[model samples]
Target: MNDSSADSFSPRLLRQAQEGGYRLINAVSLKEQLERGSIFLVDVRDRADYEAGHIPGAICYPLPLTIQARLFKRWWLKKLLCNEGCTNVVFYCQDVNSLRSDSAARAAVISGFPDVYNYPGGLEDWVSRGLALETGPCCEPEHHL
Candidate 1:
């Protein structure tokens, strides 16, 4: 994993993400959302971490690009997420307290996604809960690239 000073999760950041309209979703809730379909699940982790394992059906849209898109290329990111016909857009990361995922969720809201959620109970929580995971390259490379 590439370690950067910014790669840290903070409670204050989480609070800001929540204040920005990112609802928190637990692992169980996330599982239900997945089963219900029509939800755009985004994994905002590194490519290697995503490729190694992730919640089934999640597309890799790494945090850096997500933040950049949100800050500098808002319309492009907004169009990409909104045009997908999903009822909701959800983002997750390696851990529940991940600033990466929280930031992505905040970005989604900033991009005008009304129904954005942050699965703070992220991959670690999912795995700990014994939820099944999928491994391989993301099926939707367009989202990641």
Candidate 2:
């Protein structure tokens, strides 16, 4: 296992960290998982970053604001709180070193989410691989001109 360096995390190193607790998926693996319908690919980037672009089918769940206090506390806990089966939840962020995806994974574990994964390369690596991403209407509009 490599030292946990938030600043210089490579996909290889990230894979090592993932072995212990979380399952880290790469772009190819994510694509396969998407086809299998066995994983939820979550984009943990900020709203602005998401507005710019994101993985298709990925939901905009900002890690810092929503993971622990909102999604887990409000939604995931309503069912059983502690016995939620280990479903596959995949988290991705703009950068591997960012606190967003890392904290998101930790929060998922704390929330009783069974299987938590992180996409270390994130959007940066995703696009680099010539993968197609989706873009939605930039933001909520006050009125439709």
- Specify the highest-lDDT model's number: 1
Using TM-score as the measure, the top candidate is 1
Which runs of model 2 end up more than 4 angstroms from their true locations? 1-20, 65-86, 137-145
Worst 10 residues of 2 by lDDT: 136-145
Deviation of model 1 at 142, angstroms: 3.8
| Model 2 per-residue lDDT tens digits across residues 37-82 | 8776777677788878998878776544644555543344314222
In candidate 1, stretches whose alpha carbon ends up further than 4 angstroms from where it belongs are: 1-14, 65-70, 73-75, 82-84, 139-145
lDDT by residue for model 1 over 1-145, one digit each (tens)? 1111222435665566548776666666678778878578988888889999999989877666554554643445566655645557888898855677777777777777868877776899899999999998854434444
Model 2 TM-score, all chains together: 0.69
lDDT on C-alpha atoms for all candidate structures:
0.71, 0.66
Per-model TM values vs. the true structure: 0.77, 0.69
Deviation of model 2 at 70, angstroms: 9.0
